[model samples]
Structures are given as structure tokens and as C-alpha cells.
Target: MPPVAFLHTHILVVVLFLVFFAIKAVLLLLNKRDTLDRMRSKTKIVDIVLGILILITGGYLLFLYSGRIPTYLIVKIVFVLLAIPLGIIGIKKESKGLTVLSLLIFLYVYGVAETNSLAMNKEEPSVAPITNTTTELPVKKAPEEITPAEAAQEEILNAMGETLMANAKAIYTQVCATCHGEDGGKGLGGAALLTQSQLTLNDRINVIEKGRGLMPAFGSQLTPQEAEALAAYTITLNTTN
Candidate 1:
């Protein structure tokens, strides 16, 4: 299966696991012992299956990272490992304290993964200046980092228009995440690692609008503005200068 299929399967399994756990936790907290027990008995096989699926799918997705894993992802994985056994034992023993604690940790891990931040905040725009060998230069800020005036100036410079900056994250998630992966380090299907990309902004835009090697040109699928937006978003994934 393709990496995107694995990504989708991982998400679906995780959602089901969270919802199932939440329901069981609520029933236990409300002292619905009979109902909880009956539900658990009926779904015993399902519970095992879901657990296995979570591990299988999650492990496959992690494998796509190819050693360029981010710090937040590592932390998320640690918490998930801690949460799973706690949840199982908590549910089995009817311990409210452990159950709640495990649930909280799972929720936290989900947030951290989605936001790509330990603090669960949206990542700040990657506007930090790149250090030059001989002289300091202002690195071009991401679309989200620019003021309205700066955006207008950018439009003049690139002629892609301000709409190119709007909803870039959403665009990247929908159109680029399959090959690039979430943080752009997946390198699946021969996709380049965006985090280590050294291409300038315009060059990146050209690649997105055109095509390089195994990657197909998205020009027909995306408007010029949308293509530019995706290019700008990919720049934020660059961690290496």
C-alpha cells in the first residue's frame, strides 16, 4: 500500500481507539459496571483488533520518517507508550485514577502530534533569519509571518498574489502530505526531504508548479496562486539551512 493509505489507516484506527476508550472510561466513572462489563465482553475481540491495528499502522507511519523524526513526535511516541499499558490496566482493574490519567495522556499526545508542538500550540511561522557565512541576511518570512504591507510587497515581487498565502497549511496537508509526510521528511516514493531542502523560494515554486523526477506536476490540479501557497508552506518545513 501507499504511504497515504497508511496515513489514513493510522488516523482511522487512532480515532476509533480514542472514542472506544472514552466511552469505556465514561461508563466506568458513572458506575455503570453492568453495562461496561457487557460492552467489554461483546467487544473483547474488537478491542484486541483495534489495539493491534493501532500498533501496526502507527509503526508503519513512523517507519516513513526515515530517522528525520522531530522532537515533538518523539515525545508523543513516548507518551503513547506510557499511556497504552496504563489504560489497559486501569480499565481491567476498574481504577478511576489510572484510567483518567491514561486518558489525559492520550489526549495530550494527540494534541502534541497534531500541532507538532510539545506545548500544543500552532507552530510559529518559520521566520527565523538564516545565518550567512560572511554577512547577515534577512531570510524571507513565511506567509503567516508577514504583515499586510509585507504581503503586498511580496505580491509585487512574485506576482502570485496574496491569496497564495492564505490557508497554506491546509493546502499542504491535503496535497503534499502523502509523499512529503507530515513534517516533510518522509521521503516516500522518492519524495525529497523538505526539512533538508536548500532550494530558494522561487526555485521551490518552480518545482511545485512544474515537476521533478518521480513527482508529478500539480500545475493542472492547482491554480497558480494555490501552487505558490504550497511552495511557501514547504519552505516552513526546512530545518536545515
Candidate 2:
């Protein structure tokens, strides 16, 4: 399949799954047992189809990231692995809690999928240097200490950051390079030479995300961080040339 088609199907299947789960969650919450039962009976085949598509499409795409999977994707994979059993168990046991939990999990995966970030409320903390230790052999500067747990988490985020830059490079090559040229100085696509662009980073992000005139809108095509990375990458084109 074409990259665009592959991406489109991947997105559409996941969105449809969310809608399917959301409807069921609402029914369970509203105590509409009879309605929920009827809908279940009618939608079983269709739901199966949706689930199959998600697995097939998702699995096919997974091969592309074997050595380069990002941290957020790891979280998403875990949730997707749980999704099937959660659905079956939730409806069979008529557990409102499980149903609600499933909805929230899916939403989190959605946020991570769309934004390419952990989407956690808290930021990962940086390592701090121990200061002013008493009885030190010397009054020298203290080396930074990173707890083992914090180090692992930082490693994951750093890998995620690397993944973002790699993605930005790919996006620039495949989407922007044709017009901006490899050096980003050519305007063959009638695009403003990215090297000469005076737009602020945010402005460039806005234009890329929303598009202007001949440019295509990437708001839905690229994640926010990916857009930001691409904006940053464009500036490097000038330096390289």
C-alpha cells in the first residue's frame, strides 16, 4: 500500500475503535443494560472487523519500527495488548469500572499516538548535583547523582527525543524536500526558500500544521512535536548550505 493509504487506514481503524468503545462505555455507565445488550449482539461482527483491522494494520506497521520504536509506542502497544481481553471481560462481567478504565486507557494511547509524547501530567525530573556535603575530602564540585530509576526514565525520554529528530528528518525529506530542495534553498515547488524564511519557529509550525496556499495542511498528518522538529530542522538547512 502507498504510505498515505497505509497511514490513513492505520488512523481510521484506531478512531473507529475509540468510537466503538466510547458508545459501549456510555451505555454501561447509563445503566441501559437492555440497550447495551442489543447493541452488542448487533455489533459483534462489526466490532470483530474493527479489532481485526487494528491488529492487521498495526502489526504490519510494527515491522517498520522493529529497531526504532519510540517510548510512547511501547506504552501504546501495552494498552493495545490489553484491549481485547478488557473488552471481552468488561462486557461479560458487566463491570462499569473496567469499561471506564478501558475508555481512559484508549484515550491515553490516543494522546500519545497523536502527540508522540508520554502525555503524563508531570515532566521527567532532571538529575541534580549533590551540594554542600559535609566531611568531604575536598571542597570540590560534586558530581551529579542520578537515581537508577530516574536514569532509566531519562533514557527512555532521550530515546524518544532521538526518535523525534529522526522523524523530522524523514518528514523533511519526503514532504518538504521536493519543494524546498535537499538544501532547502530551492523553491522549485514555488515554496519560499526555507533558508530565507523569516518566520518565527511558531509561525513556521503554524504554516506547516495549517498550511498556506499551495502547501498542504499537515495538522492531521504530523504530530505536534513532529511539526516542531520539522520547523527546527528547516533552520539547519540554512546552516548546512
Tens-digit lDDT track of model 2 for 206-234: 88897763466788988888887777566
Which is the leading candidate under lDDT? 1
Candidate 1 stretches with Cα past 4 Å from truth are 123-174, 177-199, 202-241
Q: What is the TM-score of each candidate against the true structure?
A: 0.61, 0.52
lDDT of 1 by residue, 1-241 (tens): 8555676787788889889899999999999999989988988898899889988987876776543577877888789889989998998999999999999999998887666678977533254422221221124677587667545534433553344444666777787877777777665434677866777666877887776644656788888777766776676566653
Q: How many residue pairs clash in all the candidates, one count each?
A: 0, 0
For all candidates in order, the CA lDDT equals 0.72, 0.65
- Top TM-score model: 1
- In candidate 2, residue 158 scores what lDDT? 42
Worst 10 residues of 1 by lDDT: 129-138
Deviation (Å) of 51 in candidate 2: 0.5
